[model samples]
Target chain A: MPERIMPGGVMSGVIEAVISLLLVAGGIFVFIGSLGMAHLRDFYMRLHGPTKATTLGIGCMLIASMMYFWSVDGKPDIQELLITLFLFITAPVSAHLLAKSGLHLRLKHADKTQGKPVELRPEEVGDKPVPHPDKGHG
Target chain B: MLSIALYITLALVVMALLMNLYRLTIGPSLPDRVLALDTMYVNSIALIVLLGLWLNSKTYFESALLIAMLGFISTVAVCKYILRGDIIE
Candidate 1:
């Protein structure tokens, strides 16, 4: 009869399986995010797609990297932690600024699936009526 | 075991890179392009980290860090340009 595998071997196998699952799951999330980027109609909505995916997906990949390195060296591997930190910090801010700039440029939102702009009342414009000579002309 | 994981991660990263390229190519608006470029930068950093793992070298982390820092600056510059029509003004 073949000898049974040791508990330690089984445990290692389980850990490896978990890491593999994480890598595949992260990849799927990234692919979905890209699909969202492609399918979304408006630039503002598209901004969310990659930002969410890259942050979370890169995070998952970094965790897998840290785990793999720690297992091999028998010590904590911290470089991935730094990369994760950088991603978390920058992704949102960059996305926000990009979206804001898009709005500032008055780029027409592409979701014409909805109808024309609803005109706002004078009070809605509030505090600042049309710039005297510049309005209803340009 | 480690090598296998590294290769799998590399393949995934390359796939992600291709997706970003698609976004960069066909993005409808300027900000859309910028957003794709930003995503590409982040993915590139992740790719570098994976490469470091595959090569068993700590040195590649430096490039990863540089990518992160420079990537942010570039995004900010692009955003500024979009908002003001000039990066410096």
Candidate 2:
């Protein structure tokens, strides 16, 4: 491994190692998350993967980005942190909203899903009157 | 080492993006497609960050941040539309 000599004579080997580790780890998590998104049998089941796993994956990558910029610029970059915080905050909220919308639509769930609702009648969904995708269009 | 790691990460993120595309394409219901899109945004953020590191470019930082902000807003808006049949009502 060739050593990288930073502008200020900073020892870059350790920082680079840490960055590389974080990058590789984050990449793997990201791939796993996407894999789950693609291969899952049901919508709710598919929701489980990217919401949590990909958020953490990006968080790892952002941290490595922070470290890389900090080492090069000789100052900690707060922008990456902003993204990390934004993603962490929004990921769950979006997931919740997605699930709620799914519920509102009475989307089908896999039979094997533990705790799957036995039935979702339209009236039980409340006064809004759930829009039936079939009756409205076809 | 860092560049090599960046390249590897870039490839992985690209693959992730492709998988997300697959989900978006075949999602059976509206919410499913929306979820796929939301995941796509997050994956793209990772992709942008990886590119920034690979090119040693500082300009990509703002773009990444912008993507994060916009992606979240769009996801929320679309979800709200799905739930209420309208965004602002």
Candidate 3:
């Protein structure tokens, strides 16, 4: 009877361990971030929670993926990098737009929360009237 | 050892997903829900990457990328709707 051993089995084991550690850490960050989102009283504060967590958490996980693939296949697997880049660029923009809209809608928060007052846009307040200084001449 | 670590990672990700779900359900306003959903999208991307590692396949990375792109667009559209009451002019 002969014992069989899979090729690259040991190396795969090491790679998997590393990737798993990376993922667990990333997940912890994400979980904490979500908790912040759920527990925060104000919309603006909640906005910061997810933005920081999602970006860093996703970035870490993507790097883990890149590491795992590069180790096993010995090439720079760049797909994960592209995903990270996309997330980084868009997360802040989306958060900003949402915050701006929240302000526009006058979303209120609990007392003791000191957010800057929403700047009333001229059009929103109906304060911008057409110029009528010369209307009598017409 | 590797299996144990993978299982732990999976558990943590699942916990994160559950937390995000809670936020989505308890959100008091529309933007709150939108923010929670956006967080879920980001978490989902991370989950996909971890799945790729566990399954030992690079194909899942593509799905993660797709989610990132689609999630961003959807969030933007939702924000626009909330701001102006319409997505298209």
Candidate 4:
């Protein structure tokens, strides 16, 4: 019956079910991740939403795509595989850069974030000037 | 049966896209909006993949790739603009 679902290659009934299930799961994960983005209070917390949840979500979708094309199209399409690789490689780099930019701009951080950002004035940046009133002549 | 399942999945993904839109529009900070846009693009890829399956087409694959590249580049560009007023510099 499941094999009848496709007009293409050699997918069995069980494999079809698995692929569909995976697709649904991936969709749900993507939704949850986006939901976190909308719902979380702070920007850094919001970063977690897309970076962690959506990354996994997209990864799942790519795997399902790979499996579906491999069996139904009768060719092991590596395009999805490449996307998967590209996403996994880039997601972290983007997240790190985004977070770095956020920190660099001195974006407001949640109270719970450890290691509070140092308040560096533009003039006092170089030579590691100590913040002692005794040496505080500007 | 499979069609029915795919339809349900499509609805869920659409709902997610709506959420991303909400964040993109009403997010308090620039970073929040940028994050929303990033997540939205990723969600769009998922939607395109689902649409491809529904229509039994492969051409959407190229579109998805384009979205992936553009989304990343735009995000980094915007973040750079935020960190420094000039993107090129």
**Which candidate number would show the highest TM-score if scored against the true structure?**
2
Clashing pairs for model 4 are none
The lDDT per prediction is 0.71, 0.85, 0.77, 0.77
**lDDT tens string, model 3, A1-138?**
112123455456666667767777777778778888888888988998889976887787788778767776778877888988888899889988888777766788767665545445554422343234666332
Candidate 3, residues B8-56, lDDT tens digits: the string is 7678777878988988998888989999899998888877877776677
Predicted structure with the largest DockQ when compared to the true one: 2
Per-prediction TM-score, please?
A: 0.77, 0.88, 0.83, 0.84
Name model 2 segments beyond 4 Å from true: A1-5, A115-138
lDDT of 4 by residue, A69-133 (tens): 77766778877877788778878877876876666656677888654447544422222323447
TM-scores of chain A in all candidate models: 0.71, 0.80, 0.73, 0.77
lDDT tens per residue, model 1, A21-86:
666666666666766776787886787778897678878877876775665566787777987898
User: How much of the real interface does each model capture, measured as fnat?
Assistant: 0.47, 0.87, 0.75, 0.57
lDDT of 2 by residue, B6-76 (tens): 87888899999999999899889998899888889898889888877766767887998898889889989
Question: By DockQ thresholds, what CAPRI class is model 4?
Answer: medium
Residue lDDT tens for model 1, B1-89 = 54565567677778878878988998878888898888888778777777765665578877888888899999999987766566753
Q: Write the per-residue lDDT of candidate 4 for residues B13-72, one digit (tens) a residue.
A: 899899999999998777778888888888898888887776766878888888899998
At residue A100, give the lDDT of candidate 3: 70
Poorest lDDT segment (10 consecutive residues) of candidate 1 chain B? B1-10
Minimum summed lDDT over a 10-residue window in model 2 chain B is located at B80-89
2 against 3, candidate with superior lDDT:
2
Alpha-carbon runs more than 4 Å astray in model 4:
A1-10, A119-138
Q: Write model 2 residue lDDT over A27-102, tens digit each, in one string.
A: 9899999999999998889999999889889999999999988898888978899989989988999998887788
